[model samples]
Target: MKNVIITGTSRGIGFEMVKLFSEAGHNVLALSRNSKPVSDLKLKNVTALEFDIANEPEVVNLSAYLQKAMKTVDVLINNAGFLVNKPFAEITAEEFKRSYGVNVFGVASLIKTALPFMKTDGHVVNISSMGGIQGSVKFPGLSAYSSSKGAVITLTELLAEEYKETGPSFNVLALGSVQTEMLEEAFPGFKAPLSATEMAEYILDFSLSGNKFYNGKILQVSSTTP
Candidate 1:
């Protein structure tokens, strides 16, 4: 069984991934700002870590903790992210910085910390959004969020290329409006979004396939393909 590290596991998509992976017999390290409410099924091989991903000290401590734990991670899911749904004109500098801090910098920090423990066949999945792929007319308030996700997509591609010769695979999954708390916070009444469980299953399947053909590319999963 693979040992996986998943961020943003307090709720939504990350939580679902932790549950699914644990049930599939994978050792899961679930990290979030708050402690995850434990379920009976998660007690077997799931370890929940509570820390702020945006805090450099916390991330450093996490790295040291992992080193002491002596468990090599087979996969790292860069799933912790934040969104600010405000128009560009009204967006504050602090808001933009906060968004980037969590969405971009946090991922980079975690990857750096986890890279040493990753084996040759390891996988890294950066969860991006369809907004990162193309301009969104429907969500003009999400300029900051979209731009941050776009950066994640670019980083994912660059890392994939950098690791191409190194054997480990990296890819970006540009999800199309998955129904999660983040989505609800962004667009409260939005309909037709893919469910969290659906997206989790898709991610699990993709990661287990051992396919590197989609490396460095943004893979979009949506309810309605256009």
Candidate 2:
């Protein structure tokens, strides 16, 4: 019934969000570098758009396209990310920039363009990693990824405060490892405790309810049992 926009919809958690939201009867604007996954879904409620999230031009184009098609966006999930698991000493400046380009700058650009179309009481959920949290799970070589996510958390907090009078709420979710391509690439040989579908389900609930009372929160999501 509501309009939702999701980034990184080509696979993993973003893909699952597309499926979940579409099935829940929401109009979903699914953005990804590769549009095949969402195109293949052939859902009536889902519209797939292919674009480079890290590219400002592409993000701007997407925003214009959506503005023409949708009157208001009820939820915006900034889930697209890039991960580089290299030793801090080995990580080049270029590598760090690439990671931030996608994980941070891309997210900010999308938000800037989409804010105009966001509905009142809308929710903006920035997907971050648990590694970004001060005392959450830490990996050996995820410095770039963790730091980018940490920045996202800070950005979310500042936006929430800056837009307190505005109807839309901003919050960040620090997620534990989930079974996804990004996870496998970041932590080779390690098994994740949660599935993308599980995480998407939990996120869907929060996207609808979390804004009621909470904003600017860094929510750490993980399994209830070990």
Candidate of highest TM-score? 2
- Model 1 steric clash pairs: none
Off by over 4 Å in 2: 224-226
Residue 42 lDDT in model 1?
A: 52
Residue range 127-181, candidate 2, lDDT tens digits: 9988788766577788898889999999999999988898589999988889999
Residue 58 lDDT in candidate 2:
90
User: Which residue pairs show backbone clashes in model 2?
Assistant: none
lDDT of the structure predicted as candidate 1: 0.82
lDDT string, candidate 1, 79-161, tens digits: 88899888899999999999999999999899988888887788888988877776543467877888899899999889888
Alpha-carbon shift of residue 19 in model 2 (angstroms): 0.7
Tell me the whole-model lDDT of each prediction, alpha carbons only: 0.82, 0.88
